[model samples]
Target: HDVTADDVRLAHREGYVSVEHLKRYTTLGMATDQGKMGNIIGIALMAEALGREIPEVGTTTFRPPYTPVSIGALRGRSVGSHFRPLRRTPLHDWNLVQGGTMTEAGLWQRPWYFAQNGESLAEAYVRETATTRRSVGLCDVTSLGKIAVQGPDATVFLNRVYSNAFAKLPIGKARYGIMLRDDGIVMDDGTTWRLSETDYFMTTTTAHAAPVMAWLEELLQTRWPDLKVHVTSVSEQWAGIAVAGPRSREVLEAVVSDPTIVSNEAFPFMGVIETHLTGEIPCRIARISFSGELAYEIYVASDYGPAAMDLVWGIARPMDGCLYGLEALGAMRIEKGHVTAAELDGRVTIEDAGLGRMASTKKSYIGSTLRQRPELMREDRPRLVGVFPEDRGETFNAGSILCAADNVAGLGEGWITGVTHSPELGHWIGLGFIAGGHGAWYGKTVIAADPVRKGNVAVEIVSPHMIDPDGERLHG
Candidate 1:
C-alpha cells in the first residue's frame, strides 16, 4: 500500500536490515507497479536509513514480465480444452478401436472399460473382471512410470532410497519396493527389476512418475553426488501390456519365440526375461501379477506397440479372452487388497498401510530412522484393513467414514480408500484404514457412514486379502 522512509527505518530497527528483508517487512515493491515505479525510491530510502551507499544497501532481485499485462494477454491460446495438453500411450487409438471408454489418468487418457453389446459401465467392468479370471485378458499399462537406473552404484543407490533391501537382488528378478519421503511418510511403491549387475529398471505408479524422477535427480545431485548412478525416465520409450488371468501364460507361450521360457519352472513368479515375440519384435517379459492371477507384463518398443497388441489379441481372443481396462484392473486389485495411490496418500506411513514387514531392518534407508519416530510408532494410528458389507448386498463408497455402531458423525476412526464389486467374492468389498487394523477389529462390525451421499451401511472388518488370503492363485 503506502510506504515511506520511516517504514524502512522501522524495519531496519526490527533487525530486517537487508534490502530483501526490508522489502518484505514493509510490503514494498509488491504492489501493482511490481517495483517498476517505486523500487528505486524504496531502495534509496533503505540506503538512507542504513547511512550507507545505495549500492551497499543492495536491491531485491526482480522476476520477469517487467511490465504489467492484462489478464487477456496472459491467457492467450490457453482457453477451453487447450488449457492443458494430453499425453497418449502407443495403444491409445487401438484401445478406442476396441470400444474402450476413455478416462483421464494424470494427463493421459486411458481406457476405463471396454464396452461390448451396449453394456453399461457397471455391466462392462463386471463382465471384464469375470472374463479375466476365467480365461485371459489384456490391459494397457504403458502409463506406468518407467525409469532406467544404471552404473556400478545403482544397487547401492536403490538400497538407500527404498525401504526394502535391494543390494543382493538377483539379476533377472523383480522385487516390489516402497519409498518414503524425508518426513518418513510413504511416497510411492513399485517394482524394480535387476536386469544386470550394473543396470536396473523401475516402474512407478503413473501419477508419481514425474515427481519420483525429480526426487531421484535431486537426491543424486545434492545428497549423494559421489555415488556413480545415472537415472533416466524411459516411460515414453516402451509400451507395456499386462496379460493376466489363469490362461495368461498360454497366450504368451503361443507367441513367444521360445515357448519353454514361459514355463513356470523356467520363469517363475517375479522372474524377468528379455525375449522376442513371434521371432521378430524384441520384448521383455516379467512374470508379475496385479490381478492376483497368473500374469506377465510384456514390454515392446513404442513403435512396435500396435503390432504387439494385435499379435497378443489375436491369440487371446480365440481362447475366450477379452480386453479389460482400468475399471476391471481396480476390481481385481481390490479383491486381493493391493494398495494404490488411494491407500498410499502422503499422510500414511509404511506401517499404516500394512507394509511394515517390508521395511528392511538390516540396513538403514532414507526413512528408516524418521519412520521410527515416537509419534509414528503409535499403535493407535490408522492401519489398512478390509471392509465388507455385513449384508453382502449393500455397497459403500470410497471416502466413507468407518465408525462405531452408535457414533456415525464426525471423522470417526477410519475411512474407506477404495471400493469394488468383487466378482471373485460375489459381494461388494472395500480396502480401508482403521484405528487398530484387522487384529483389533476382526469379527466386529462398524458403520460405513457417508453423510454427504446419504449412505449408512454396516460393514464388517476383515483381512485386506479378501479373495486369496493365501498364495495359491498367485502362484498358479
Candidate 2:
C-alpha cells in the first residue's frame, strides 16, 4: 500500500520483472541531464515500504557527458571574435576606413585608438591614458557577458546560484552579486538587473558569462528541477560602450536631444533603464561607469552598435574622449580595490576576496558542507589582499613572490596578477593573492618567491581597497 499501489500494479502488468526492474525498464535517471527532474528516493522508498530489493528496482545509470560538454570541445575551433559572440560595431566598416587596429576589451572589439604618424602599441596606450585623464575617453563594452533569465522561478534560481540573496531585489533595480562554488569560493561576480518581477538580465565579466550561465542552469535543472526558470545568453544582441571622464556627461548630452531620457537624475549611478540616447539615434543607455569616474555606458542593437560608437567618438574627439584601453581599466580596477576574475579565480574563496559576508551560511545550499571545515575558516589561508613596494622608485614585476629575504633588492617579489603605474596615485600599484597575508601578517614585509630573481622583490601588506577608501566614487 505504501508503494503507489496503483502505480505498482501498473508496473507489474507492464512487463517490469519487479519494481526495481520497472525503474530500469523505464530508464529512470538514465539520461545525461541526470533525471534532474525525476523521482529517485521516492521510488526507492516505495520499494522499501513494499519489502522489495533495490536491484530488483535497478537504478537509472545516468550516462556520461554526464554534466555538460567538455570545455575544449565546446570551445571547439573558434578563437577570439569567432569563439564568443561579439558585437562588431556599426562603424566597424569605419575601422577599415581609418586604418585603425582593433583588439578585444572584454567581448567587444574596440579601436585601440587611431595610430598617429608612427605610434607603437605602448605609445598608443600611454597616449590614450593621458587623453582620458586630460580630456575625455570612450570604450566599447559590448562584450561584457549578458544573459536574460525569465520564468516564474527566475528569482529563486538566481538567489540559489549567487552567494547573495536576490529574491528580495525589487523590480526596476539592480544589485551587484557574486557567485560561489559549493566550497564557498568565489566563482564570479556580476550585476543582476531585475527587468520586471519575472524577467531579469545578468551581466558578468566577459570571460565567465557562458560558464556561469551554464552553471546556473545545471543547478536549477538538477538541484531544483521543479523550479520554473530559463536562462539565455544575449551577449551578442546588444552593443555597449563606456564614455568616461569629467567631460563624459557633456559629450553624451551633446549628442542626444531630450537629454532628460538619459538624465543624471533618471539614469543615476547604478541605475538601470530601457531608454534611448542621442535623440535621432535612439540607443539604450545605463549610467554605469567602471572607469572610476562619471561615465555612461550606451547600449544599442547590434545593427546600430557600431554607428552609435562612431557618433560617440565624433562627439568625444572634440571633448577629448580618452582612447582608453584594457591596461588602464585594469589599473583603475586594482586601485579601486575591485578584485575581478584574475584575483577571484578558482583558487580563492569568497572570504579571501573580502566578501566572506557575501555567502549565506545560515541556509542549506551547495558547497555549504565543506565550507565549514577548520582549514577553510582559518586566517592563515592564502587570503586575497592589496600590496605595493615600499620603495616607490623600484619596480616589482607582478607575480613576484613576497619574501622577507635578507639580501634581496630589486629582486622578484610576490606574484602580481595585475599591476599598473597609476596617474592618480603617483606610484605603481598592484593587487594579488598573498598566502598568509592577513591578520598578524599586516604591515609585515615579504619577498618575491620566484626562483629566477629570488629575494630581489620587496612588498608590504596593505588592504585591498587602496583607492575609493570608503566607496565615495561608487556612491557619488
Candidate 3:
C-alpha cells in the first residue's frame, strides 16, 4: 500500500534519471499538501536509489506561490504601518513620545530625527548637529557591538588579533585598535579597554559584532588551541549612551555619585571608570568621543537604559544642549574624517585607510606578513580622502565614480563612499577613495558621475580633516 525502496529503484532504472523526474513519474511527493513535508524524504529516496549523494541528486527549484493562494491572501490583512516587522530599543516608546521620526537602523526602529513643530527634517538634523557641537548632546549608541573577552592569555590573544600592541596596555585605559583580515584588509576597528590583567572589554562596529566574535573563536579553536582566551558577546545585555560636547564632563560630574570618578584628574580622555550614578544606578562611563569633542559614553543595564538616557537629558537640558540623532552622529564623524564601515567596505587595506602606521612594526600581528606584500604597498592604491563640492549647494550621492574630465565612463580614478551636508563646513562634503591618494590630485578638479542616480557634480579634493585639522576640540 506504501511506496517502497523498490518503487524508487524501479523508477530510476526505468529512465527517471533526475530526482525531479522520479518524483513526477511516481507521484512520490504530489499529495494534497504538494510535497512541503515529503520533498526531502522523496529526495533522499531518489538519491539512495541512484547511489548518489543528495547534493549530486540536486533539488527542485520551487517557483513563487509555493502554496497556491488567492490574490487577496497574497496581500495579508495587515497593511500601512503594520506591514513591516519592527524591533524596538529600550528607549523606543520614549523616543516616540518625544515626536521622533523613527526609521529603520538595522532591524531596530530608532529615532532618525526628533522634529519640533513645523521644522523640516533638514532643519531638525542641522540644528541637532550644531547644538551637539556647541553644547552637550546625548545619543543612544547601544547598537554598537560589545564583547567581553577574558582568560589568562587574553592580552596575548588580543595583541595577535588586532594590529596595534595591547599586551602592555595599563588597566582602566582604553585604546583604539584596528583589526585586519587574513588578506591584509581592514576587518573592523574599535576601542578595547583593559579591565584587569586577564579581563578586557572590546567594542566593535554594530554590524560586525557576531562575525567578529566568530572570527575570534575560530582563531582560538583552530589556530591556537593552547591559548586560554574566551569571548562572549554582551551587546544585548547592556545599553550605551554617548554624551558628547564641551559640556559633557560637567553633566557627568553633576549626576555621578563620586565626582572624582569623572573628574579630569582622575578620568582623563581615553580613561574608563565603572561606578554608580544617583539612585544607585550601576554604570560604566568611558571618556571616549566619536564627535571629535570631549565626550563620555555611559553604559548601564538594558532595563535601565531609558532611565539613564532621561538622567543625561535632564542634566544636559539646562546646559544649553539637546538630544541628537543618527543624522548628527554621521555628520560629526565625517567632519572628524573617521573611517567607519561605510568607508572600509571590506576591500580597503589598513594602509589605504590612512591607519597603516597604527599597524605595529615592533611586533608581528595576524596580517603583518600579508600587509607588507608588494601589491598592498603600491603607491597608487586607492586611499581615503575628503571631497568638497565646488558649489556648496550641490550635494553628491555616494557610489558616484570620480574621474578626470577626460576619462571614459566606468573607468573612474576613484569613487565616493559616503556623503553628508556638514554643518561645521557649511557645505556638502564627502569621503572617498582615490588612486594615488592624498596629494596625488591636490587642487585638481574632478567630476563625480552617478549614472545610476543621474547626477554629475564637480568637486575639489581636499584633506579629509575638514573640521579640526589640529585635533583641538577632541583633546581639549
Write model 3 residue lDDT over 1-476, tens digit each, in one string: 15556777788789897877877777765655456656677778788877889999987766456685677877885777677655577777778777788777765677788787788888888898899889988888887888999999999999999999998899999999999899888999999988888999899987688789999989999998999988898887888889989898889988899887777888878998889988899998888989998899899999998888888889998998988888878888888889888987888998888888899998978888998899999999998999998888898988889888777377699998888888878999989999988799998888999877857899888888878888777677
Candidate 3: pairs in clash: none
Question: Per-residue lDDT of 214-325 in model 2, one digit per residue for the tens?
Answer: 8877887788889888888888787777877767777877777655655667666767666555646666565665666677777777777667777788888877565565
146 Cα displacement, candidate 3 (Å): 0.5
Runs of candidate 2 exceeding 4 Å displacement: 1-100, 104-117, 133-135, 261-263, 279-282, 361-369, 406-414, 451-455
Q: Estimate, for each residue in 1-476, the C-alpha lDDT of model 1 and write its tens digit.
A: 59877787788788898888887788888877888767788888778877899999888877756787787888899787677888899999999999999999887889999999899999999999999999999999999999999999999999999999999999999999999999899999999999999999999999999999999999999999999999999999999999999999999999999999999999999999999999499999999999999999999999999999999999999999999999999999988889999999899999999889999999988989999999998999999999999999998899999998888878899999999998878999999999988888878779999977958899999999887788687688
- Candidate number with greatest TM-score: 1
Please report, in order, the local distance difference test score of every candidate based on alpha carbons.
0.92, 0.69, 0.85
- For each predicted model, how many residue pairs clash, with residues at least 3 apart or on different chains? 0, 38, 0
lDDT of model 1, residue 140: 98
Top candidate when judged by lDDT against the true structure: 1
C-alpha-based local distance difference test score of model 2? 0.69
lDDT of 1: 0.92
Residue 419, candidate 3: alpha-carbon lDDT = 84
Weakest 10 consecutive residues of candidate 2 by summed lDDT:
407-416
Alpha-carbon deviation at 410 in model 3, angstroms: 2.2
Cα TM-score per model: 0.86, 0.74, 0.85
Model 1: which ten-residue window has the lowest total lDDT? 61-70
| lDDT over C-alpha atoms for residue 94 of model 3 | 79
